[model samples]
Target chain A: MHTSKVLVHNRDRSEIESEENYLPLNVLRLSKRFGGIHALNEVTFNIEEKSIISLIGPNGAGKTTFINVVTGTYPPEAGMIYFQGQNITGLPAHKIASLGIGRTFQLQELFLSLTVLENAMVGCHTRGRAGMFAAGLRIHPAKADEKRLREEAMENLKMIGLEQRASDSISSLPLGERKLVGMARALGMRPKLLMLDEPVAGLAAHEIENLVRLIHSLIDRGLTLFIVEHNMPFVMSISERVIVLDEGFKIAEGPPDDVRANEKVIKAYLGE
Target chain B: MKNSEIDRTHIPFIIMIAVIILLPIIIPSAYIISVMVFVAVYGVLALGMGILIGHAGLFSLAHPVWFGLGAYISGILAARGWVSPGIGIIVSAFFVALISYIIGAPILRLRGYYLACATFALLLIAQIAGGQLTNITGGHEGLLGIPPLSLGGFVFQTDLHYYFLSWALCIGCFWFCSNLIHSRVGRAIRSFHDSEIASKSMGVNIPKYKLQLFILTSVMASLAGSIFCFYLCFTVPSFFGFHLLVELLMMIVIGGIGSIQGPLIGSFVILWLRELIHIYFGKIFPVMTGEVDSIFFGILIIIVLIFMPRGLAGWVEQSFNLGRRTYAYFKGPGA
Candidate 1:
């Protein structure tokens, strides 16, 4: 085991070397309120290049709110979000996704009626360069692009070990399989930034282990990940930096060891 | 059914062409051919309704208003000789798409019963306006002496000729709609229908896709309306009435909502039932009772709903699924 602390907040020679060519990916500062409840307050976070960051909190800690605001699912009324160093506060979700960010839902939102392959192909929406009218007319270029999309979609399914099940309807799949299919669909977009909302939620322990290893493998391939999870042990083992929230306010931020030992985070979980 | 699964939509169109080709060969009745022409016309109209209500989950009630708009616009243009019949059809479909794009944006924001009410009222308003505005629509008497559709140099004069033309148009429209339903946007529409909020989070441009589909379906409806005027050589206010709108819905529900073949199948079944009811009941029942077609239609809708909530198209799919499962089970230990 590599028992080393890669302090993301601190600067080292290699870290500075990497940062010199670093492009700003995503920066968020948000405070959201609903009537008498402060759902999220003065929350600020940054996702750097090639990092796997975990957001951990108890129930109602607004972990999802943070993801929603950053991904353009929910517009934050009080603060701004910057993607790729440019302000992208209130752009539509699809526009934000087209800018290289992709996501999967907590409950696994697969197109249930469509086949697994077709569902994955929907991710190629922005990537397809050919016009729909040309495709309808079956022009040579559009036909070629469609063939390419089908092949790429199959390749993506194979990435998640679902290539054999490509023709099966999503509704025929079990819950764990559907979750994997959802991840496969997001991966089909060839996204630079992937935000997974509770990717392993409700899975069996064995399934969770498989998923964690897969995610680690993906991160090693240079994809950046921001995950919202309640699985603290997994978060501590894999995440470089852990951010803890209680009632929508950031309570602590440090290395996994520091976050795991933080008294306030311990209190927040124990109290809930 | 195995090979048919990939092109299940082509089944009804193929069956329809076969029937139309055989009808003249076997029956040789001019009146029946005219009735067959209505079936083709209704089939086209029902497909437009099916695309919106079935595939897109729009539950629109303003479909007939678009259809009527097409009829009146094309009728007025061709009747006055201001434009050729072909140009009249194009202009009519264009206005319907344009108007739906403008009005559908705000109105489609409402869902379910409220949406139904808003669109139903819209159809009612168009019907009334068409009747009241004598100068433009020709009011109660309707537009008469609309020019016949001509292709190249040949005029479509006979009922047999019109039947072939109408069915050809129906085939073209069906092909267009089936292609749309299989397109990428069609998949997005189905995803939106499954879960609107989830689709939103997944970066689907929901409102834009919804509005575009609405306009597209309206244009289809208008084209069907244009075809109707071409066949009839005249247009009447009653032809654009509310009952026809309800009938179109009935055809879609009986056939299958989202499945491409359902609309044509449902319309064929309904038209045959109506003919059967009229032949029997018109002879047996008293004049005070009107025609028994309405009652038969009501019963058919209820029976189909009770037995097949997914509609006839769904039933066809279910059977195919069962067959596939059985085949897989035999091929392996367990499927």
Candidate 2:
């Protein structure tokens, strides 16, 4: 319901009102190229603050590249990314991450040998302030940061219903659980925007149900979630809006039902 | 096995302190005592490298250079007679930290084999500098008249004194390092080992953390080297040479690569192996050579990699069931 369009571009800085309400993320004509292939070309979309939006497309539709560019994983050939109305394009991945954007890998990139809680704690790196000296000495600030990180990580694991297994080795968890742990780890960053890449790519029906519930809970907690997934039913059921991409271009964008019924989206999925 | 890796680093350290206190009293044999002293010095060296290669999964062959530089800097500074050896060691550490920062900033950009090779080249260059810089290093004859470490006017006069000092320093380093590894920076450094992408997305500044750990490892090596300087009362180009790197690599592999205790345990194993070779294989060759240690180290490394990639320390950690029982026993029924 909070879905919006890109309403401002190349505007004079003096005229931009600080008091105006803004989307959490806004992108303008993002483009990426690998040699001759246009992995992403002139794609544009804006995510509303604290809304659940789904991005879906057929294989090789540049869904992953789009997310990678937006999250600063891949350098865009040309584009401007605005996070909370500040230009974030061309920033390094960690810099962008520290600016309140968190993402999970398509293949869950959980630290395999560490405990689940530790994995989440590592995600809270940007939030902590103790340097090597402070950490090594375990001084007041360092101790407090570490203690706070543990609590934050534990809180995230609890939020994801994984506090019981917090001490369990990450590798011991099943794939679905590992993905959730990855989400919990990303949550440790306490990002304004949390992006999930193919969050339910390989989940059972019950796992999907659990993930849907988790997503809804995250939304209820006043967090924006940008999910790149292929599960049409899951997307339609959970997403307030869906943006359809094909061949590195946005084909349709609207409420999930409208996007689902759009002829362009149908053609993109089933072909002409 | 469940969580021993995190908890067990301290157990060996405490046991090592007890051993450090008891060993000099029990063994009293000068030659064996000196070897144990070598274990302490090299143990610190290995701990430094362990953080780099073991926990952070960095490959570096340049640690010996840092150690050598620490020795020379501390030796040169302490040799002046005005500054205390303790001050000399501290100054040497800062120098090594600065130098490592300057060098690491560029070298860490090269990943895997390239990084290893860059560090290897650095080792060779530093070795050459040690030999050629005669005015400063005193060349092959070694810098002479370097005083023993003195604190509050009590001078250490013998190997026994150094054994206590070196092991004490080793214990101190271990304590701080253990604290470090349990802290947030430690987790950040370890995160780089498995998932750079995940760590990056977590807002971990990978390059910064890498360089920070690099400098810390170098500083630890500098500390060890400084102690080595004070203990020897002289400096040599050969003390921190290429062979020392090979020896350190063997210690890391044999002891266990990642954990803090790995290097200390590996240092003990290698030293014991040296003593064994001296007892048994010394008769086979009229003149002992570095080649001898190489053959033994190469074979041991292969055996370690194949049988237990984690090394002896890892093995100890795996069978820490005995340790847990002992710990539980000491703590009482409820604890």
TM-scores for all candidates?
Answer: 0.90, 0.92
Q: Please list the residue runs of candidate 2 whose C-alpha ends up more than 4 Å from where it truly belongs after superposition.
A: A1-9, A12-19, B1-12, B80-82, B322-335
Candidate that would win on DockQ: 2
Which tens-of-lDDT digit does each residue in B1-335 have in candidate 2? 83786468568667877887888788788888888888989998998888789889889889999999899898898887757887888888999999999999999988889999999999888888888888988888898989888878889888898888888878888887878888988888888788888888888889998998899889888988988888888888888888799888889988988787788889889988988887777778748745686688788899999987999988877779678989999999998
| Model 2 chain A: ten consecutive residues of lowest lDDT | A1-10
Highest TM-score model number: 2
For model 1, the stretches where C-alpha displacement exceeds 4 angstroms are A1-24, A130-132, B1-19, B288-291, B323-335
Q: For model 2, state the Cα shift of residue B20 in Å.
A: 1.2
For model 2 chain B, give the 10-residue run with minimal summed lDDT.
Answer: B1-10
At residue B322, give the lDDT of candidate 1. Answer: 97
TM-score of chain A, every prediction, order shown = 0.88, 0.93
Question: For model 1, how does the per-residue alpha-carbon lDDT over B189-258 read when each residue is reduced to its tens digit?
Answer: 7777876755665556888888987887788778778878888877878788888987898999999888
The residue-by-residue lDDT of candidate 2 on A162-249, one tens digit each, is 9999999987899999999999999998898999999998889999999989888888888899999998999898888899888888
What is every candidate's C-alpha DockQ against the true complex, given to 2 decimals? Answer: 0.35, 0.78
Colliding pairs, model 1: none
